[model samples]
Target chain A: MNSTFANVVARRDLLRELTLADLRSQSQVSRLGWLWWVVDPLVMMLIYWVVVAGIFGRGERYAPYPVFILCAMLPWKHFTSSLNAASGVLRASESLIKSIAFPTMALPITQVLARFWHHLFGLLVLFATSWIAGLPLGLALVQLPLLLVFQLVLVLGLSLLVACFGALIRDLKGFLGHVMRVGFYLSPTLYGIDLVREQSANLGGWMADWLPRLFLLNPFAVLIGGYRDVFFFNRMVEPEMWALLTVQSFGALWLGYRVYLHFDRRVIKFL
Target chain B: MSDAPKIAREKNAPVIEARGLGIWFNLQSRRRVSIKSILLGSGLRSDQKVLWALRDVNFEVADGSVLGVIGPNGAGKSTLCLALSGILTPDEGDVAVRGKVSTLLSLGAGFNRDLSGRDNILVNGAYLGMRRDEIQSRMEEIVAFSELGDFIDQPVRFYSSGMRARLSFSIASSLEPEILILDEVLSVGDQAFQRKSRERMQQMMARSRAIVLVSHAMPFLRELCTHCLWLERGHVRGFGEAQEMLDAYEAELAPE
Candidate 1:
């Protein structure tokens, strides 16, 4: 037991190195350099605002639709990209995987961390836009990092699952891409949760109560919802919401971690 | 024989120990005969065995000692290297490594081919458990040692096998390890670099770090190792003081 703990701790040092290499590889192609992190999403926010908000003049009602979408989009982007990159992290680093005694989770953690750090650039833009556009800051903004912790735990677990499974089955990437495509419409990123509840409360049908409960447990749901509360609602997160998010986070983490550890030794061979 | 227990209790105990180590390749059949197909009278022979890579190998090395693992072709030297490096788990017996180790099994095992030379160094250093600053501190030393000149900025794939081997060796030896496992890497470089590598290794050994060198070069084996393990057909042909083991191993291969 003590040896296992020591091995796990020894992995952190390697994780620091992997993270730096990851960032360096990411930043090597820079005409605009690290600015691209903020710019890529800023460009997307503008494009969405133009087509969806400007053309339809929905900005009048949504007020800062950019801010709304930014909040919703930021975490969604983080979650999906983390999942997408993680799906290939082990396969991509096949050489390192085969040669070293690196902790298997290092791959997923770096994927999640890189995506999370990249999303921070977009986040700085969000906070600045919220202030400049007069969305009004609240004490809740201070708590967003704490809320993001739950989201990260949930994503970390999901990344582990995706990385291990994806290493074994090459076709899983396609299956996941299709699932994310369907999920985009189903998730509350573009539409409001109240809108879904009002119109499609029975959309879940047989699993009505059970499915939304599971769907809300999707990590990004709580994540984007919490984000919305901070920026849009300007109110503190409800105690029940925070509690449910914690449970959901732990469940994702536990399931993801177990799956990862089970297949770790064989992942490199499969790759 | 009298010193076995004393040796076991010493500081930096034989960095690697393997007793009865063996690896069997259980590759699933290429053409999978489904259960339905088999039941429908599609006859197939399911049992197949091609190679016994390593079989019932036992050996020991002392701290700060270099053990040259020399073998004939297909004698399981690489498999032994993998087992010692913890890359491949054995099916029988056990292998235990004390403290940290750096394994240079092959030139580019941990290298990222797409990344620049500098980036591969960082990745490789991390594989050896060096932090960013640690790698940073040793970066100039590694680059200078490789002597790739202006090509250090280029991708690793652009370099010849020799250059890749040099960089790998340089990064590996840069970090002082309690255990260093080398697999035929010294022979990859040009003659000048080979001499340089041997010198660097000698300096490393002077600090009392154990090195397990695997090669077919008997001269190299005679030059460095206090002990030589002669592996034949995945089992020990002889193990003792360098010259006696090497002579016995050569006589076994000399003639019928």
Candidate 2:
């Protein structure tokens, strides 16, 4: 047990350096460079704004729709992209995985860290925009660190789980892409939770009542809700919401870690 | 050895010990039978077509000794190197290494070509078990050793194959690993660079690091190796002193 702990510490050192390298290499691919990280999300927000505000005419309903979406969109983007990249990291690091003896977990972890780095930059842009829009900076911003910790644990777990199964199944990438696409609509990134609750109430039944609660059960929705609650609403997260977030984060982590460990030895062969 | 005691076996224990090591690969059939299809109750053969890359292979390497692994193409030489380094777990047996191991299994295996040579050095160094400060301190020395000069600042994709080999070897050797595993990477760069690397490897041996060198170069093996193991078709054909195994391997290759 002591040796395992020491090994994990050593692995952390390597992970830190490799994560920096991974991030650098990501931006090096294009002449536009790291600007793409900022621009890509801006473009995404623009599309979301045009579609919901222009076509659906829902933008005025939310008033400050961009900030509303940005709160959830930024975290959603981080979660999805990190998982997408991490899921293929083992296969992507084929030579390293086949030749080196370092902890395999580092590959997926570096992806999460790199994506999180990009997400933090994106968050900076969002905070500036929020200030421009006259959204007051409150003590609620302090909740960010705790929210991020929860999100990171959840992301790390999901990434490892997907990556392990991804190594064995050639079609996992395609399947994941579809799942994430459906998840985009299912998540509360574009629509407000109150909007869903109000609409579901018009349907008039327990199913309608369960719909909002069920949306909260989607961990990403809960995470987006947390970000929205802290940064936008300036409200303390509900106690039940806290319990749900903690449970989702730790539960995903436990499952992911266990799945990764089970497949660690077998993954190389499949790859 | 199955029931061997957990402790109290330190009578000149080998730095690396592999017993009954085996590994197999599944050969994907011409048409991949999807798991979904199988679960739906198709009658396709669920038993995978297996290719045994290594089977029941066993060996030992002691401290201060150079053990050479020699085999032809597809003879599991590279797999043996990987297995010893703990990259590939054995299916039937186990390999125990007493100390830190650094492997040069392929030229620039972990390098990000988009990154400059200096960054690759930092990454590869960290991966090979060196700390960040240690890599930074050794940076210039590694560059000087690789003889890449100003090219060290350029992205590695611009580097020639020989340059990549030199950089990787220089980074790996600088780590001063207790167990060094090389896989046909010593024949790197020009004859001058080869000679220089050969001298460096000899110096490593002089420092008493247990070395496992996998190569097809017989003369090189005879020159440096204290012991050798010959493998063919995933089976050990010979294991003994370096010169004897080289002689036997060469004679076995002679035409009838």
Best by DockQ: 2
State the lDDT of candidate 2 residue by residue for B1-256, as single tens digits. 0112223458788888888888887675323334465467662665868888899898888878899998888888888887777777777777677777777676688999999999999999877767789999999999999999899999999999999999998987786778888888467789999999988877776665688988877787888899999999898988999989899989988897
Which predicted model would earn the best TM-score? 2
lDDT by residue (tens digit), candidate 2, A1-271: 0112246566677889888998888889888888987887777878888999988998987767777888888888888898888777887888877777777787788889899888888888778767877877698888889899998999988998988877776667777888999999998888888888998899888968898998888998888888888767878888788899999999998898888887786778777
Query: TM-score for all predictions?
Result: 0.82, 0.92
* Off by more than 4 A, model 1: A1-8, A54-63, A201-211, B1-15, B22-26, B29-55, B63-65, B70-75, B89-92, B108-123, B131-140, B148-164, B188-190, B206-209, B222-256
**DockQ (Cα-based) for each candidate:** 0.27, 0.43
Docking class of 1: acceptable
Question: Candidate 1: DockQ?
Answer: 0.27
- Report how far residue A71 has shifted in candidate 2, in Å: 1.2
Residue pairs whose backbone atoms clash in candidate 1: none
Which tens-of-lDDT digit does each residue in B222-247 have in candidate 1?
88888888877877777789888888
